[model samples]
Target: MQSNPGSPHSDLTLAARPGAARQARRHVARVLPGWGMAGLADTAELLASELVTNAVRATAALVAAAPGEDRPPVVPPDRLGTIRLRLSRPGGRLRIEVWDADGRPPVPRAADADAEGGRGLLLVAALSAGWGWHPARDGGKVVWCEPAGP
Candidate 1:
């Protein structure tokens, strides 16, 4: 886990596991008391769930691509790989960033009338003021979205 030098706020890192996502939700809840941002607690949990789910799925695909003998270590239930979720209150807005080791950028598809698997990012875009993805220097990618109006 890399750290940003001279940054005051600490970043949260979790393995792409289901339990980790839950734990992250709980942690965010606990921290919300200090943030004092109305309705932010629920928003944090929802966003975390969506982002973690995507990370886990991507990690699973990567593991499956590797040779049987080179597969990754045992991942926790509902978790697939390493993911970093960072929350920062640098100024007026809350920045939510979810990073995974897969370098592929997510392609947001237009959901079919009856489709069930393509709505996560759509929800994110709706709730967030703005969102985008970029490749990380270490071979993975970071997808970030900011809440509207701080």
Candidate 2:
């Protein structure tokens, strides 16, 4: 994580592992309040965790498809690169973004009630003030959401 105490922006890049989401949640939980956006901490942490989890899953999917990539270590220590979580206040509104190597846009699904997952983006859409995604220059896509008003 790279951030200054009163800075308006902070960035964290973590290995694409199962624990990455939890790390992201902790990052958001701290950065938001440090930036005087404590009101957004809960929502930001939740949304950041969701996006990071999705990114990790996408990375793991590719890893699981490779010949010997199905190793014990979840991320294999940088084999699949990292997931970046960014927090910024654009126009005074808190914006959270997660970047991964997946270029395909996120698709919201109507999850079965009995499903154990698949509600990440749904929760994001319901909780965020506005959200979207754009292709990143580094070859992936950055999914972003605004949790606070302008």
User: In each prediction, how many residue pairs overlap at the backbone (N, C-alpha, C within less than 3 A)?
Assistant: 4, 0
Across residues 64-137, which tens digit of lDDT does each residue of candidate 1 receive? 67567543334343434678887766675666778777778877778898997778888788888888898877
Which candidate comes out best when scored by TM-score? 2
Residue-by-residue lDDT tens digits, candidate 2, 37-116:
78777778888999899889876676566667443324334535788899987788888888877666888888999999
Could you give me the TM-score of model 1 versus the true structure? 0.76
Stretches of candidate 1 off by over 4 Å are 1-8, 66-80, 113-115
Provide the TM-score for each candidate, comma-separated: 0.76, 0.86
lDDT of 2 at 148: 48
